[model samples]
Target: MSSVNYYSPEGLQKLKDELQDLKIRGRAKAAEDLREARDKGDLSENAEYDAAKDAQGLLELKISKLEEIVGNARVLDETNLDLTKVLIMSKVKLKNLKNNMVLDYLLVAEEEANLAAGKISVKSPIGKGLLGKKAGDTAEIIVPAGKLQFEILEISR
Candidate 1:
């Protein structure tokens, strides 16, 4: 089954651009490599040619997978997002109840998740637990370490 993934406008555009690059420059580079390898003589003993062919195959597979992802992606408009609860594309602030530490995160698609940037994938344990949670609500999320409680402080687009 092909499940659709949500992305912001910028994120969607990045995917499109990457796909275009792979289709154009990436394919061209692979073809050039194959041609260079083929010129190295005797196909039966051409290790370079075999390696080049394998590289091209891997590149094509990557391109195909990217095309599928781009085709199934849906762009989400942040301007129209509902801030009543935590959701994909929502910037959320939470307080760790036990540690009293506050953290900010932007819930996003799996491809867009970056820990340093505070963007967490909705598929993540904390992100999943935060989904549909409103301000003042406490979420008990289970992680690899253990279960932890967080209080939703705010939610914004």
Candidate 2:
């Protein structure tokens, strides 16, 4: 069974858009490729035809998986988020206890995690450690590099 995933409205819309594109443009491209491959040869000896079929199969599988993900996605209301503690969709400010450096991150669903954008998956080490922590709370987390400590500075939607 597929688990439900929570997303921001923009994130959900992006998934829906990708699904639509795969269903329409992606399928059209696959069909065109198959037609071209079929026109090129005798069925028994056609490598291009085989490759095209395999590509189409992979494409369909991707579309199916995407459809399932989109179907199970739920949009979270940003305006109603709790700011008292770190949670999904929470923008949190943290202070590294070791270096006294401040960092900002937004906790989000796994699919929407982008390190460059400062969005972390709730399942990630730091994100998991920060969850449910209120301002002024200290969290000790173990990451791949090593053990780190952070002080929660603030939490906001």
Most accurate candidate by TM-score: 1
Per-residue C-alpha lDDT of model 1 across residues 128-150, encoded as one tens digit per residue: 99999999999999999999999
Cα lDDT of all candidates, in order? 0.92, 0.93
Candidate 2 residue-wise lDDT at 155: 90
Instruction: Report clashes for each candidate as comma-separated counts.
Output: 0, 0
Cα displacement (angstroms), candidate 2, residue 126, comes to 1.7
Task: Please provide, for model 2 over 1-157, each residue's C-alpha lDDT reduced to its tens digit, 9 standing for 90 to 100.
Answer: 8998899988888889998999999999999999999999797899999999999999999999999998999998667766798989999999999999999999998888999999999999999999999999999999999999999998988
How far residue 109's Cα lies from its native spot in candidate 1, in Å, is 0.8
- Candidate 2 has an lDDT of 0.93
Off by over 4 Å in 2: 78-81
Clashing pairs in 1: none
